[model samples]
Target: MTQVLGIVDIVWRGRNIPVEKGAKFRLGGIKNTAVTYGRKVGRAQEFQGSEVMATTELEAGQRWGNTWDPGEGELQVVCDTGQTFVMYDAFLEGDIPEITGGEGGKIELKWAASAPEEIGV
Candidate 1:
């Protein structure tokens, strides 16, 4: 079964933004590796550590302007399933949409791992 997890809220810079529908959160991990000469085969790889990235999108006009500062701040994402993710060294990405067609605006939050535990999540 495919379980759908919805984002409940996002707290950033001491302000909260209640996420509406169509919110998305993504996390990624990458290893620090390098290709080297192998003994038997052609080449091999050596990996040292991992890097992590966390990102999410939220609806604008709901405390986004007050909380978002480019290249600064941290964010905490709470989901409906009791899962929480802390995004450190966060920064704001993408432009806040402005239109008169009654369409909603969205802001994208991007962050990297700042702690040991956050490097793989």
Candidate 2:
């Protein structure tokens, strides 16, 4: 039988964020291309992933924005198939996560990576 792959969790700055069930989790496929003319002309490769929902606690008389801004550090996504993706130099891209009143509650955080990530099995 073939084993299925599943995203176990999303860890940032050494913290395991509680992700919502059925949340959107996608890894942007590795891409390579060459630029004909531009500022930086050369072959380039990119590695990125979709937003990783991070569970948060909103309390009354509390603030948002900078207070909840996840500075930057190593971001990891572990899979059930013993696959791990590590973004060595990564930081929070967007200013703040989307806010809305609905099911449970979740914050969508962009997995912005500066360079190629290290894939381990």
Candidate 3:
């Protein structure tokens, strides 16, 4: 079955955190830093790709529970089209809920590379 990338379900640990239809997620993006290189005329900077990670923003109603904490676990990002990516030793960041008026809060999740060796130069 073909999985749709536009819509996906975020499974933390084992439970599914319901998300809004327009929920945004950045899956497996390039993480990199710039380095100065010596050039004949001048110095140039370049962006080198680093470890891959995932970032997501979820609506208030989609929040998992009352507490927002980073636990040692795996985050399963499954797309409706059937594609799935398992983030190993995953942890959450920017999980604070922002309240605006009577609307549900919005929480952001940043899944970083767990292993230090993978990110080592």
The residue pairs that clash in candidate 1, if any, are: none
Error of 3 at 102 (Å): 1.3
Candidate 3 segments exceeding 4 Å error: 1-4, 27-67, 114-121
CA lDDT of each prediction against the hidden true structure: 0.50, 0.61, 0.52
Q: Pick the candidate with the highest lDDT.
A: 2
**Candidate 3's residue-wise lDDT over 1-121, tens digit each?**
7434677676777877655565444544435444555753443444332122233344545544532566656666676666666766766654454544444443445455433222111
- Provide the clashing-pair count of each candidate structure: 0, 0, 4
Better of 2 and 3 by TM-score: 2
Error of 2 at 92 (Å): 1.4
- Tens digit of lDDT per residue, candidate 2, span 38-101? 6677877776544443454444554564325666677787777887777766677766666656
* Candidate 3 to truth, TM: 0.52
Score every model by TM-score: 0.51, 0.61, 0.52
Give me the overall lDDT of model 3.
0.52
Q: Tell me the spans in candidate 1 whose CA falls farther than 4 Å from its real position.
A: 1-4, 31-64, 96-101, 104-121
Runs in model 2 with CA error above 4 Å?
21-30, 34-67, 116-120
Superposed Cα deviation of residue 121, candidate 1 (Å): 14
Model 2: residue 64 alpha-carbon error in angstroms:
7.4
